[model samples]
Target: MAMNLPSQRGRGRKAPMADINVTPLVDVMLVLLIIFMVTAPLLTAGVPVNLPDSLAKPLDQDQKPVQLSIDDQGRLFLENEEVAETDLPQRLERITAIQAGGTPPQVFLRADRQLDYGRVMAVMGELNRAGLNRVALVTVEGTPK
Candidate 1:
């Protein structure tokens, strides 16, 4: 096998490549961006439920709101963790106590469409008794019928 040798003109060496190839970097960034985009919606809420559809406008939120979910079987979930009815009032009071300001924290209540009206009211009553009066019902956006 014949070996190739460096040329001896002046100092025999090839100068290091000064230009950076950004194509690989851009490709990697775009791949990461796509991965995040695909997974973002799935990460938004932990519990799954069949929500009623409504045409109401979405509310503007300045701070993170509390998530209170009621499943079809009438189970309550506060921030994805299950809590019993007897313990709900105290838990809500704790939430209120942890707030930094006088204004009560906003609560977004997500109830399954198949749940009984009274069951929803009972949970809402617990929230009311705990001084968490700022509550909004969460629903899927729907087209006008």
Candidate 2:
């Protein structure tokens, strides 16, 4: 007597898998990427100043440096904290002392495009008097006229 084996014609296709599905995960990741791209530009914190355009390349800024902002109205800010011109040197000295060892960190200066040349120079003079010698002017790359 011959025994009957299952025929291949009975199973035309393989059974569906019960594995994990990543479509939802991929969709969530894409949404997150788009959200980050939209909000990243607006997250920068600083006193708003229309910076003068330059053709210079951006610096290799990894560490957090002291920031100075000179607005169109000639108002001054040190790392988001407003400081008077008469007392800026004192504040800077205190900050330098806080750093303690090693050379003082460089200052990133952002001045408005409409600010007077003299005012910017005056701030530099005061910065020099405060022993903050390394100053880097921050400007955006200009577009063609």
For each predicted model, how many residue pairs clash, with residues at least 3 apart or on different chains? 0, 0
Q: Lowest-scoring 10 consecutive residues by lDDT in candidate 2?
A: 7-16
- Per-residue CA lDDT of model 1 for 59-108, tens digit only, reads 99998999999988888899999999888988999999998477889999
Model 2 Cα RMSD, 1 decimal: 6.1
Error of 1 at 24 (Å): 1.1
Give candidate 2's TM-score.
0.77
> Taking the tens digit of each residue's C-alpha lDDT, what string does model 2 give over 1-145?
9965555766655555679999999999999999999999887756898888888888886568899999999999998878888878888898778766877888999999898899999999887977889899998898623
> Which 10-residue span in candidate 1 carries the lowest summed lDDT?
3-12
**Candidate 2 Cα outliers beyond 4 Å, as residue runs:** 1-18, 143-145
